[model samples]
Target: MTCRLCKRDCQLKNSHIIPEFLYRSLYDEKHRFYRISVEESEKSTFIQKGVREYLLCGDCEQRLSKYERYASTVLQGGVELTVSRDGNLIHIEGIDYVKFKLFSLSILWRSSISSLDIFKQVSLGPHEEKLRKMILAEDAGRDCEYPFIMSPITHEGALQKDLIIQPTKTKLEGHVVYRFTFGGIFWVFVVSGHRIPSVVVSASISTNGKLTMLPREITEMKYISNMATELARKGKV
Candidate 1:
């Protein structure tokens, strides 16, 4: 089997689309794993672990793990970030732009190559090969390329925990956008033909290595809640 990222004709390893640690907060007291589907029928699946694919070779997997470790620290709030709250927006500072940028790109690239149904919305088309090469070379690319914005899902209580919303692709302001929820975080990745706007870039980890976290509102929570309800109705809970 050839490695998807490095194009190496080596034995492929079981690679996780999303890092395993990200799912830690989603487990029940009995250590069971639950998965929810967002299709019209609203199906639910239970498992003991995160989704995996036979994609990368051992070397490539290790390479991606480097970025994942850094990302885990950031997501776990292990790193010191200068945080400020103004109304609904939270501004964060002291981020390592290069590392986080690569981490975000890695997630996007991984989803593009994944065969899992939940990640089906992330076909990169012509951009697929480009991103593969970038990841292989450890190139994060320019800030304007594949820029992204992030927000933490603030839904309280057990009902909203460990929920995974399938990735949805759309166009926003003429640029291609992909939105998905995972590990209590909502991420919006923009595929722009032109350089991303200065304002958007500023908000990204691209400039000055800073970050800003926006709060998810009622409408967003409603969407997840509705999905949960469907799953419950189907006896998937």
Candidate 2:
């Protein structure tokens, strides 16, 4: 198969659409993987591993791994989260703008091209080819292009252990958006439009190589949980 990212006619590796480390918290004591349903009619399901596909060659896989390592560190709290006095915002500093930017784009681009049902909600349309060229050329583009904002998912009592929700698509301010949860964090990727809000601008990876975490609302958690319930049920049936 031709490597999707590099377009090389070589053996493609089973590349994870989302990095594996993002699913570590979803593993059980016995190392089983459990995922919740986004449909109300069905319950959760168990699996051994995350979603992967024969997408990239070894070289492209390694290239993405470098950014994944850095993102893993940030997600694992290796970087300090500086809280504001009002507690509405948290800042993460010293991120590599280019690497993290490419990482985010890679996730979107991969999901857009993936055949897996989980990523069906993400279709980059004409932007898919544009992003492919960017990844091929190692171009992170401007921060305003495909800007993203992130928030950590907080459970009230017990964590929703070993759960992975499919990506959901929506629109915001006339821009197409895709939202997903992994590594206990919710990532919202805005694939279209250039006029990012001030709040999102502040949290951009290109903004002085730092990111900000805004508090997730109660309704947002409920919506995500509902979506997970539906996806789980659909996957099972």
Candidate 3:
């Protein structure tokens, strides 16, 4: 198929319906995230500006394949918490558990007031409620900045993740990280000032810096709107 964004005769990249960075930075204290205080926007400029080209295709992804390998360390493991009976009538916990939370965020989900307002917009609504339901499976972290969510799934592919903060705003407001996971499908949120182009090329390189997989999946999901409305509610203090 042709590229989705460019509509060219080439492959495309797996665009996170949200953005990957929103979750990837949770465990990584080094991503350097920034938040513009709702109160300080009038007096101060942005401390860290977001990237222009956040997501990419193989043509774009090749520019940073080595970074994907480091992500494995952040993809924490999971444990099945359900009780099942075997042929011998022995109670056993299923092994289909995943650690961490799946990642996502709306680049379009930014706040109109200030960076701080962004938090308020997300934390105080039905969105936060859904975010809470999803994250109930993870931890609150040391400062409770990182959000986490969990849900027991049957035998199937699931994802676990943590979001490290990439400070693009202030030196005082360090990065905020969180964890939220789910069953089936990988979701990535790139919290940025840019918007998704609806199409692009993407390729994957091995952890050893080798070109491995070139993904052209037209990344789309049905639960994103529902999840966003839910997750937005989670940003509340």
Candidate 4:
């Protein structure tokens, strides 16, 4: 099969749909993680590795890994990046607008193109090809083009950093949104052609390389709380 990202008829490598770094904290002492499903019919199970498939070739994988590496460093505070907190809102500065933005877009694009069951809901339709061209050309585009709002998942005033839930699709401010939670952060990407709310655009990565993360509690979201409870009941959390 042709490599999905580069579209070249070359040997495709086992590429992770979601960057492996995001799953590092989710692993257990035995080097395993629980795959929880909110649906009652689908029982939660344990997995030894992150989701992967033959999507990209060696060159394309390396190309995307650069962005992921940068993002992981910033997220893990490996760099001397300044992070400030005000009340419940957290602000991070000194980010590379291009690299960070591309990383976010890559997540959306990869999840959409992935055949993994966890990402089956991410059908981007026309936006899929558009994102492909943008990523291939290293065009992050305007922040408003595919704006995303982020929030840290907190339960009882503590951050939840060890769970990976199924991505969900919803509508926010009349814009289509896809929500993903992993590595203690909840990312909500707004995908639509119509005018997006300015409030939503401002929540995304700024052109000046500033990013904000608002805190959201699990108690406020019934679905997440239910899933957490189910996962805890079945496996070591």
- Please, what is the TM-score per model? 0.88, 0.85, 0.20, 0.91
Candidate 4 residues 1-237, lDDT tens each? 788777999989999888999988988899888776655567768888899988999999998999999999877767767789988778888899889889988989999999877898999999999998898899899988998888888888888888677888988878889999877888999999999999888879988888888989877877687676876775534
lDDT score of residue 66 within candidate 2: 90
What's the CA error at residue 10 for candidate 3, in Å?
56
Who wins the lDDT comparison?
A: 4
* Candidate 4 lowest-lDDT run of ten: 228-237
State residue 177's C-alpha deviation in candidate 4, in Å.
Answer: 0.2
Candidate 1 structure lDDT: 0.78
Task: Give residue 170's lDDT in candidate 2 (0 to 100).
Answer: 91
Off by over 4 Å in 4: 39-43, 226-237
Clashes of 1: 0
lDDT tens digits, residues 1-237, model 1? 889988889999999998888888878886668776655465566778788999999998999898888888887768787888888778887777767888788888889899888899898887888888888887787777788888777654222336567787888777788887876778889876676667777666655776777777535666567766876776666
lDDT (C-alpha, whole model) for all candidates: 0.78, 0.77, 0.28, 0.86
lDDT tens readout by residue for model 3, 162-215: 222221221112322222232222322222222322221021111222111111
Off by over 4 Å in 2: 36-44, 79-86, 157-162, 217-222, 228-237
lDDT, residue 89, model 4: 79
Provide the lDDT at 162 for model 3. 28
- Candidate 3: where is the Cα deviation over 4 Å? 1-72, 75-118, 137-237
Candidate with better lDDT, 2 vs 4:
4
Give the alpha carbon lDDT tens digit for every residue of 1-237 in model 2: 899888889998999998888788777887778665555565667877788998999999999999898877766756544444336677766777777888888998999999986788899899999999998888888777778888766656333324456888998777788987777667888877467676665676664676777756535577665654655557753
TM-score, prediction 4? 0.91
